[model samples]
Target chain A: MVNHSKKSINQYAGYIYLLPGLAWIFFVFAIPIIQLIGMSIRQGPVGQEILGFDNFIFTFRDPLFIKAITNNIKLLVIVPILIILSLIFSTFLYERIKGWQIYQTIIFIPVILAVAAMGIVFSQILQLKGLLNETLRVLRLNFLIQDWLGNQGLALGSVVGVIVWKELGFGTILFLARLMSVDKELYEAARIDGASGFQLMIHITIPQLIHIIEFYAVLLIVTAFSFVFDYILILTNGGPNNQTIVGEFFVYKYGFIYNRFNIASSVAIVYLLVGIVLMILRYQIVKRIDS
Target chain B: MKKIALSRIMKQIIMITMVVIALVPIYYVFVTMFKSPDEYLFNKWGLPLELSLENFKRLMEGETIFRWLINSLIISGFSVLISILVASMMGFAIARFDFPGKSALFVAVTSLLVLSPAVLVIPLFKSMVKLGLINTYYSAIIIYTGIMLPISTYLLTNFFKSIHNDIIDAALIDGCSLFQIYYRIMIPLSMPAIVTAALTNWLYVWNEILIGLIFLQSDKMRTLMPGLSLFKGKYTTNIPLTMAGVAVAIIPTFVIYLMGQRYFVKGLTEGAVK
Candidate 1:
C-alpha cells in the first residue's frame, strides 16, 4: 500500500516536471496555431465576419502565389543536385583524398555562416561589375557574364546557385559522417572480389548510405520549401519582377508587408499541412533507419 | 597504376576547385571590409594595398551596431538557458519516469521538430502584439525558446535515455528523489548532449532573422543578422561599409562555431542520422 502511494506520487512528480515546458509550448505554439486557424477563415487582417474558405480562395487565385509555388517547385531541382554533389564530395573524403581533412574543414565554413550575411557577400560578388564579372572578363569569357541578380530570367537560377554553394557543405558533412560509420568489411569483401572503385561505389556504398540519403533528401526538400526566405529577402528582396519569390517569402509578404493577415494565415495553413506531411514522412524514415 | 594516379589527381583538382568556390566570397567579405570605397571600386578582387580600419571605425562610430550585438547576446543567451532548463527537466520526466500522456508528449515534440516557425509567424506576431511583447527582447526570446524547446527536449531525452537505467534505479534505491537523480546523475552525465543542444539553440537563435526581424523591429532591439540585413539595404552604395557590417555580424558566430564545431555537428545530425 505504501509502494502504491509512492508510485502515484512519482507519477505526479513527473507531471510537475513537465508542467513548465508544456505550459510554454501550449501558450507559445498551440495557442498561436489555433489563433492562426481562426484568422485564416476571417476576411481582412482585422476583419471579423465568418467568411469560410474565402481567404484561401483568394490566396489560391493570386498570381504571385502561383509564381511563388512554381518557384518553390523549381527550386526542388536543388535536392537531386545536392544529393549528387554531396555524395560525390563525401565519397572523395571517404576515400581519404589528398588534403581531405583541409577540404572537409573549409567546405563546412559556408554551412556555419549566416545565410543573410552570405547573401550580402554574394550580392556584391554577383553584381554586374562585381568580382565574378571581373574574373569572367579577365578570362575573356565575357559572354558568360550577365546581370546575375538583376535580370528576371537569371535571378532565380542565381538564387539556386547561391543556395547550392552554401548548403552543399552541410550535405557533404552529413553524408561523410554516415560514410565513416559503414562496415569496412563489406568494402574489403568487395575489393577481394575485384570490384572496381566505381562498381564498389554503385553496389556497396550507395546501398549502405541509402538511409542517410533519404533523410538528407527529405530535409533538403523541406529546406527548399520553407528555408529560402532569407536568401530571397537578402539577395533579391523578391525583386526582378518577383522572380525569386518563394512560399515562405510569399507568406511574409502578405502578413507583414501587405498587412493581409487573413490571407497569409490561409497560405500558412496550406504550408502547415504540407509541413505536417513532410514531418510524418521524415519520422517514418527515421523510425525505419533506427529499426 | 597510371590510370589510378590520373584519377587521384583528377579528384584532387575537382575538390580544390570546389574549395575555391566555397571560400572566395567569404574571402571577399573579409578583404573588402578593409578597403576604402575607391579601393573597393578599383581593387574588387585583390587584397587592400594597405589595411584600413576606416570602415570599421565608421561602423563603430554609430552606437546601433553595439546595441544590436548586445541584444543578440541577451536574447540568444537567455533563450538557450531557459530552453536548457525547461527542456532538461521535461526530458528527465519523459525519459526516466512512468507517466500518463508520455508517449503523446514525445510524439508531439518529435513532430514539431520539423514544423517551421515561418508557417505560424503571422498569428504568432499578432499574439506577440497582444501580449505587448512586440519590439521587446522577450518577444524573440520567448518564441525562440518555444521553437527550440521541442528539439532540445528531444535531444536531451534521447541522451538521457541512453544513460544506463541502472544508475537511476540504483539512485532510487538509495532514496534519491527524481529531481536529485536528475541533477546528480543526468545533468553531469549528459554534459556533451546538453552542450550540443545549447550550441545548436544558440546558433539557431543567433542566425535566425525572420523572428527577430518581425518581433524586435525597434532599432535598439534588433539583433545582428536582421540588423546587418537592414544595414545592407541602406548602405548598398557603400560596399566597404556594408561589408564591414557583414563582417561584424558573421565573425562572432564563426568564432563560436569554430570553437564548438564538434557539438554543432553532433547536435545537427544526432537524431536525424543516428
Candidate 2:
C-alpha cells in the first residue's frame, strides 16, 4: 500500500515539475506567436479592431521587401562555397597537418565574438582609410581598395564577407569532429590503392559528412535569413542606400523605428514562412543527395 | 624521408599563412586597446610605444559600462539558474516517467528549436509592453529562460535518458526517493552534460543582443552587447577607448573558451543535438 501510494505521488509530482517550463513556453513562445498572427492581420494598429490580410498584401507590395528578399537570397549563395572551403580546411587538419590545433583555435575564436562586437572592429579595419586600404597603399595595390561598407555597390558584400569570415570555422569544426571518428583503415586502404589526399577526401570523407552537411545546410539557411540583423544593424545599418536590409532588419525598422507594428508583424510572419520553406527545400535536396 | 620532410615544410608554411590571416584582426584589436591615441594615429602598425591603461580608465570613469556589465552578469546568472532548475526537472520527467503529454511536449520543444525568436521580435515586444515589463531585469531574465529552456531541456532529457535504466531501477528498489535519485545518481553521473549545457546557455545569454536591445530600453538596465553598440556609436572617434571596451567585452568569453577549450572544440557538435 505504501509503495503504490509513493509511486502514485511521484507520478503526480511530474506535472508539478513541468508547470514552470510549460507556462514559460506558453507565455513566451506559444501565446506571442498566436498574437503575432492575429496582430499581423488587423487593419490598423496592433491590439486594434478589425481583421484582414491587407497588411500582408501591403507587405508584398513594397520594393524594399523585394530588395530584402534579394539581399537574403544573396546571403544563401555564400553557404555552399564556405562549407566547401571549411570541408577542405577540415580535411587538411584531419590529416594532421602541422600545428593544426593552432589553426583551430585561431579560426574558432571569431565564432565566439558576437556579430555586433566584430562588426564594430571590422568596420574600422575595412574603412576607406583604414588598415586594409592603408596596407594596400603601402603594397602599391591601391586600385584593389574600395569603400567597403560605405559604397552602395559593396555594402551588402562587405557584410556578407564579415559573416562568412566568422561562420567558416564552425563548419570546419563540425566536419573535423565527424572526420575524427572515421576509421583510419579506410584512409590507409585508399592510400594503398594509390589514392591521393584529395581522392581520399572525395571518396571517403565527403560521403561521411552527408548527414552533418544536411543539418548544417538547414542551420546555415535559417541563420542566413534571420541572423544577419545584428551584422546589418552595426556595420551598415542597412544603409549605403538601404542596400542591405534583410527581413529581420526590415521588421525592426518598420515596427520599432517607424511604429508600423501591423506591417512589421506581417513581415515577421512572412520571414518565418520563407525561412521554413528554405529549410524544407534544403532538407529535401540534402535528403536526395544523402540517399 | 626527404620527400616527406619537404612536404611537411610546405604544409607548415600554408598553415602558418592561414593562421596569420585568421589571427590578425584579433591581434589588431588587442594591440589597439593598449595603444595611446597618439600611437594609434602615428605608428598604427607597430607595437605601442607606451603600454597605457588610459582608455580603460576613461571607459571605467563612465558609469554606463559598469552598469551594463553588471546587468549582463545578473541576467546571465538568473537565466542559467532558472533554466537548469526548471529544465532539468522537466527533462527528468519527460525522460524517466510515463506522462500524458510527454510525446507532445517533446515534439513541441524540438520544433521550437528551429524558430529563433528573431522572427517574432515585434510580437514579443508588444507582449512585454502589455505586461509592463519593458524595462525590468525580471522580464529579460524570464524571457531568456523561456527562450533557452527548450535547448536546455532537450540536452538534459537526452542526458538523463542516456543513463543506465538499471541503475535507477536499482536505486528505486533500495528505497531512493524520486528527487533523491535525480540528485544522487543521475546528476552526479551527468555532470559533464550539465556543465556543457550550462556553459553553452551562459554564452548564448551573454552574446544575445536583439532582445536586450528591444526590451531593456533604459541605459541602466540594458545588457552588454547593446550597450557596447551604443558605446561604439558615441565614441567612434575615440578608437582606442572603444577598442578597450571591445577587449573587455571579449575577455570573459575568451577565458571561458580557454578553460573549456576541449569541450568547445570537440563537444559543440555533440551539444548540437538536432
Candidate 3:
C-alpha cells in the first residue's frame, strides 16, 4: 500500500515535469492543427471576416488542388520503388565486401549536402547546355540530346530522380544498420541447413527487417509529403503548367503567395489528416506483423 | 587461376563504375568552382586547364554569400545549442526521476516526430507574427528549438536510459544536487550521444531552407540557400560560379561529418535501433 502511494505521488510529479513539453505541443502542434481546421472552414482573404466553408470550397474546386493531389500520389508511388532499390543496395553492401565503407561514404555524400545545393548542381547538370546534353553531343549522339528539365513530362521525372538519388543513400544506410544488427547465427544456421543465399534472405533477413522497414516507410511517407522543397521549387516551381505541384508546395503557394490563408489552412488540415492516417496505418501494419 | 583473377578484375571494374557514377556530380561541382566561365561552357567535366580563384574571389567580394554564411552559422549554432541544453535537461529528468505522467509525456513528445515542418510553417508564421518576431533571428531560433526539441529529447532520453541508475543513486547519497549530478555525471557519461545529437541538429539547422526562407525576409538575414538564388539572377547562365556557391555551402558540413563519423554512425544506427 505504501509503495503504491509512492508510485502515485511519482506519477503526479511526472505530469508536473511534463507540463512544459506538453504545453508547447498543445500550443505549437495541437493548437495550430485546430487553427488550420478552423481556417479551412472559414472563407476570407488574409485577416478578413470569416465566411463559412467558402475558402474550402474554393480550394476543393481549384484545378491546382487536383493536380497537387495527383502529383503527391505519383510521389507516393515513386518513393517506395526507390526504397526497394535502397534495400537491395544495402543488402549487397552489408555482405562485408571489400571497399564497402568507401562505397557507403560516397553514396551518402549527396545526403550530407543541402538539398538546395543539390538543386543547383542538378539543374546545371540537366540544363540544355549542361553536361548531360554536352556529353551526348560529344558522343556524336546529337539527335538523342533534348531539353531534359524543360520538357513537361520529363521535368517531374527528373525531379523525382533527384529525390531518389538524394534520399536512397540515407535509406540504404538505415537498412544496412538494421541488417547488421540481425544475428549472424540465423544466417549461418540457414546456410548449414542447405538454404540458398536467396532463400536465407527471404526467410530470415527480410523478416528481421520488418520493423525497421515499417519505421522507414513511415518516415519516407512524411518526407515525401513535406520535404521536396528544393527539387520542386527550384527545378519546376510546380510548373511546366503546374504539372508538378505537391500538396506542401500548394499550401505554401496558397498561404504566402496567393495570400489565401483559408485555402492554405484547409490544404494544411487535409495534409495533417492524411499524414495521421498514414502513420496510423503504418502502426497497425507494424503491430500486426509484430504480433 | 586466370578465371579467378578475371572475376576479381571484373568485380573491381563494376565497383569503380558505381563509384564514378556516384562521385561524378560532386566532382563536377567542385571542378567547375575553380574554372573560368569559358572553360566551364567548353569543357564542363574536364579538370580546369587553367585554374582560377576568380569565381571564389568574386563570390566572396561581390555577392552577399559571406553575410548569408554568417547568418546561417549564427542561427544554426544558437538553435542547436539551445536545443541540446533543453533536450538534455528534459531527457535527464525523465530518465532518472520517477515522476507522474512520464509515459504520457514520452508518448506526446515522440508523436511530434511524425509532424513535419511543412504543416507547421503557416501557423508558426502566424504565431511568430503575433509574438512580433517575424524577420527576426529570434523567430528562426525559437521555431528551430520548438520543432527540434522533441526529437533531441527523445534521442537523449534513450541515451540517458542506457546509463545505470546506480551511479546516479550514489551521487544522490553523496549529497550532490540534481543539477550537479546532471552536469558532472550524466552529461559526461552521455557525451557521445550528446555530441551526436548536437552534430545531427547542426546539420539539420544548417540545411533547412523552407523555414528560413519564410521567416527571414531581409537580405542580411537570408541564409545560404535563399541568398544563393540571387546569384542565379546576376550570373543568369553562369553555372560554374553557382556551383562554386554550392561547394562553399557544403564543405563545412562535409568536414564536420568527416570529423565525427564514428559518433555520427553510432548515434544514427543506435537511435534507430532503439
Estimated TM-score for each candidate:
0.97, 0.93, 0.91
Cα lDDT of model 2 by residue, A111-180, tens digit:
7777777788889888998888898999999789999999999888888788888887788888888888
Those runs of model 3 whose alpha carbons end farther than 4 Å from true positions after fitting are A1-23, A44-54, A136-144, A189-197, A281-291, B1-14
The candidate, 1 or 3, that scores higher on TM-score is: 1
Q: Name the docking class for model 2.
A: medium
List DockQ, one per candidate, in order.
0.67, 0.52, 0.45
Worst 10 residues of 1 chain B by lDDT: B265-274
Q: Which candidate leads in DockQ? A: 1
Residue B231 error for model 1, in Å?
Answer: 1.0
Which candidate tops TM-score?
A: 1
Candidate 1 per-residue lDDT over residues A82-140, each given as its tens digit: 99999899999999998999998899888888998999999988999888898899999
By TM-score rank, best first, the candidates go 1, 2, 3
Colliding pairs, model 2:
none
CAPRI class assigned to model 1: medium
Q: Which 10-residue window of candidate 3 chain B scores lowest in summed lDDT?
A: B264-273
lDDT string, candidate 3, B35-154, tens digits = 888887678788988778888998889658898999999999999887888788778768876755776666567667666577888888898889998888999888887778777887
For residue B226, model 3's alpha carbon misses the true position, in angstroms, by 2.2
> Model 2: DockQ against the native?
0.52
Model 3 alpha-carbon miss at residue B60, Å: 1.7
| Candidate 1 C-alpha lDDT tens digits along B183-216 | 8999999999999999988988888899988898
- For candidate 3 chain A, the 10 contiguous residues with the lowest summed lDDT are A1-10
